[model samples]
Target: MIRRAMVLAAGRGTRLAPLTDTTPKPLLPVAGRPLLEHILEFLHAGGIREVVINLHHLGHAIEERLGDGRRFGLRIQYSWEDPILDTGGGIKRAEPLLGGEPFVVVNGDSLLELHLEDVVAFHRARGALATMVVRPDPEAARYGLIELDAEDRVRRVVGLPPGVEGTFRGFMFPGLHVFEPDIFGWMEPDAAYSVIRTTYVKLLAAGMSVYGFLTPARWVNIDTPRALAAADLTLRTAPFRF
Candidate 1:
């Protein structure tokens, strides 16, 4: 089972603007509590015992608020980035803490109601190099499309080459991924980059086993003021069970 995970919390959250000027995106309040707290609770409920959160952009406040993560039932560690690496770089930087095993990566700015055990199970069963939690969204093209074949294998990402002309479904990544340790082989060391735009695209080009797991779970990406308000209303009216 995948017990270790990384939370990409270092981004400046430029879209949120003035609100993020004083507070990190992950710490922004969604319902009654900080957004990161909800993410931690969800991770804990999903059976993640150890977590490594990459920090930058007023990161100390996050450290002071979360600390060892004991209250959240997690053993938390921090990876301090000098220039604030992007998603791929952040995970690569935290490799030492993640250990040599399959692990999960979550985008710190989004809220998802998923039973992670199911996602991990699907990943292991498919023997995929990586499995992304994708959801059908009408605005998927705006988020960069991830096209999945009938078998749920990711045939194309961001409209990269080797295009499929036949029937296929397009989905959007909801910031949840299960990856094997070997995925590091496809990434450069200490370079800032997006995993989707860089690593996943390369994996698809090389005919690697990248799969997409479609989920029915409700999700919200809290990046802009509009999104933040939507998330707050969603949680207040229909809170997640797990």
Candidate 2:
């Protein structure tokens, strides 16, 4: 069982400005509680006992708010990045805390309703090096496409492995991923990089075992004021069943 997970909460969230000027995106409230609180609760409910959150950009506020995560029924640790590391670098920085198992990673700014156990099962069944939770979206191309073959193997990530012609499906990644520790071998420590544009793209190009787990679960990315309000209203109307 995957017992550890990482929540990437270090971004500056420039898009949600004015509000984010004083408050970190993760600390922004959604449905009467801090957004990070909801994320931590979701992880705890999904059976994650230990979580490592990488912090920057008003990071002290996050540390002050979340403390040690005991209140959330989980052991929480923070990876302090002096110079904000992007997704890939942030995960690389937290490598020591993640341990030697396949673990989960979630975006701090998004709300997704999924059973972590189901994602784990799918990941293990295929022995994939990494598994991404994806959903069909007509505007997926706008977000950058992750193409999958009939077997659900990721064939292209943001358009790599070029010149392959096939009837594959394209989907959008909602920022939930299951990754084997071996993924670190492909990254340079302390360097800022994006996991999607750098790591996953290279992995797919090398024909690595990267798969996409299609989900019909509800998801919301709270990157803008409108999105934040929508998420709050949605949660108030229909709470997550999970």
Candidate 3:
């Protein structure tokens, strides 16, 4: 069972400048509550007992607000970054806390209505090295894209080839995944690596089963002010609650 998770909150929200100036993007309020709080609540409700959150820019504020996991009914651990190790490094740093088991990793800034239990079950069922929660979209080029085979195993990443076309319908990653402990073996030690650029792509090259779970639910990547505002508005009117 995937009972632990890691929230990647270490990035400097360069795009969301003015708002991120005072508060980190993860702490930014969405629907009256901080985005990270909603993620914690979701994990707690999903029966996850432990969570490790990595913080870098304006991290003290997050540490002050969420000192421990007890307040949210979960054990909260902080992976304090000194030089702002990127996504891959951050996850590598927290692997000790995550232990030798497969765990869930979510971007603390992005908000999505994830079926945590269902996704976990699916991850174990498929026996993938990593299972990405992705959605089919026409605007696939704007973001990192995943190409899945007939069995839904991620065959190749979309961007590496210069003139890649829609061989298979591409999907935008929702910033959430279930990863096995072996996934870290593909990463280089002490280097700034992205799960997509370095790890996931390597898994595909090694012929590992990397699946994509297409979610029909709503997902928003809150990077810019306009996107954040739209997400807030959507969450308000949406029938489902995160």
Candidate 4:
């Protein structure tokens, strides 16, 4: 079982503006609890005992609120990025804490309700370099399209439509992933980079083992103020069904 995980909480929540100016995105409240708390609840239930959260914009607030993480049933560590390294760089910085094994990663801003154990199993069963958690999003065109083959291995990712219909369908990634320790070898240590633009895309181009685990679970990205509002309503009415 994977005991360690990474929470990508470092991004400057520029889309949320003045609200995020004073608060980190992960600390924003959803359904009366801090967003990070919800993530911790999920992680704890998923059997993750330790987590490393990457910090950047308004990071102090996160540290102040979640300091030590004992109260949340997990041993928490922080990876401070001086210049706010992107996704790839952030993960690379926390390599020492994540340990030498396959680990789970979740986007702190997104509320994800999936079978966490199954995701880990699926990743290892296929021996994939990286396994992305994806869901059906009608607005897939609005985000990077995750194209899959008949076997559900992520074959290609594109910003524009393929313009040709095939056995593949596009979906939106809900900020959840599983990765092997060796996946770091493809990255440049301490260099600012995007896992999407720099790593995953390159791996796919090289025909490496990048797969997608499709889940029908409820997942919402409280990215913008409007999204947060909608998520609050949805969450309050139904609660996360994990």
Better of 3 and 4 by TM-score: 4
TM-score of each: 0.97, 0.97, 0.93, 0.94
User: Ranking under TM-score, best-scoring first?
Assistant: 2, 1, 4, 3
lDDT of 2: 0.91
Residue-level lDDT of model 3, residues 1-242, one tens digit each, is 67899999999999999888899999988777788888888787667888999999999999999988788998889998888779888899887788688899999888677668888888889988899988877787688777776677776676643343345757888788999888778777666778787787677767788898887777766799998898778767772354
Task: Give one digit per residue, the lDDT tens place, for model 4 in 121-193.
Answer: 9988999999999888898767788888889888777642224345787888888889998888887897898
lDDT of 2 by residue, 1-242 (tens): 78899999999999999899999999999989888888888888888999999999999999999889899998999999989889999999999998588899999999789888899999999999999999988889988898999999999888876776788899999989999999999888989999999998888878899999999899987889999999999888988755
Instruction: Give the Å error, residue 200, model 1.
Output: 0.5
Model 2: lowest-lDDT 10 consecutive positions: 157-166
Model 3: residues with Cα > 4 Å off, grouped in runs: 160-167
Candidate 4 matches the true fold with a TM-score of: 0.94
Clashes counted in candidate 3 amount to 0
lDDT of each: 0.90, 0.91, 0.82, 0.86
Model 1: per-residue Cα lDDT over 131-238, one tens digit each: 999998889998989899999999888887565465778999889999999999888888899999899988988899999999878998798999999999998899
Shift in Å, residue 47, candidate 1: 0.8
Query: Which parts of model 1 have CA positions greater than 4 angstroms off?
Result: 162-166
